[model samples]
Target: MMLDADQRRTFAALADVLIPASGPMPSATAAGVPDALLDQALGYRPDLAELFAEAVARCTGKDPEAALDTLAAQQPEQFQALTLLTAGAYFLSPRTKAALAYDPPPRSALDDVDSYIDMLSTVVDRGFAIR
Candidate 1:
């Protein structure tokens, strides 16, 4: 899942475009969206890595916004998937969270029984239950 230097630069460039710096908020790369983080975020979907790399390649030497627009028009699913992965990775950073004034609630041991039951009912209704 390691990215080479070129891939890393491409990812950084893409991330900066996706979450650009604004006022006090840092860009995605500035928020620590490195290749390692991207590797972990996208590891479960190796195909996405290749797709992103190809997309970024097409974006090389082009305006970031225009490149992204082209990618969105040409590969909407891949664009969405990559955008989600990049944003997820960026926001996972403590700096990004703090910048956004988001303080996630602490994990609790208690489970939501109603939600669990509702999920089970939905699964059963969809005929996914093991008979």
Candidate 2:
């Protein structure tokens, strides 16, 4: 999509913060960009690529500090939705090591289906953590 490089970087950084490095999975920076999925996203929703540049300008105070209050206050659903979307992309990315990463083993039976759903539940609980 032709977003400015700065915007792309901001979006990536935002994704990093939203998902962070929790549990066994690596941080977004460590995981790096999911090149294939990102390319797919760029091809599909070009405008979505600008979400960070658009949100951060007004959400973060005055452009220097890293905080998210007014933005969440104003956008609410949009803010959390952006976090979920990017986090989903990142979580599905190949960088996660033991937990989130999918390893195709030669077994017909599966395990931990409930845990998978629980992990998905975290998306429903988008608690603000800029504290």
Q: Which candidate is the best by TM-score?
A: 1
Choose the strongest candidate by lDDT.
Answer: 1
For model 1, the stretches where C-alpha displacement exceeds 4 angstroms are: 106-131
Model 1 weakest 10-residue run by lDDT: 35-44
Compute the lDDT for candidate 2. 0.57
C-alpha TM-scores of all predictions: 0.71, 0.52
In order, candidate lDDTs are: 0.78, 0.57
lDDT of 1 at 121: 90
Q: Candidate 1's residue-wise lDDT over 50-110, tens digit each?
A: 7666776777777778888898999887687768778878867778788889667999998
lDDT of 2 at 27: 70
Question: What are the per-residue Cα lDDT tens digits for candidate 2 across 19-101?
Answer: 67767877765665434545554455555656644664454333322544555777765576456556655655666644564
Worst 10 residues of 2 by lDDT: 59-68
Q: Show where candidate 2 strays beyond 4 Å.
A: 34-36, 42-53, 56-66, 101-131
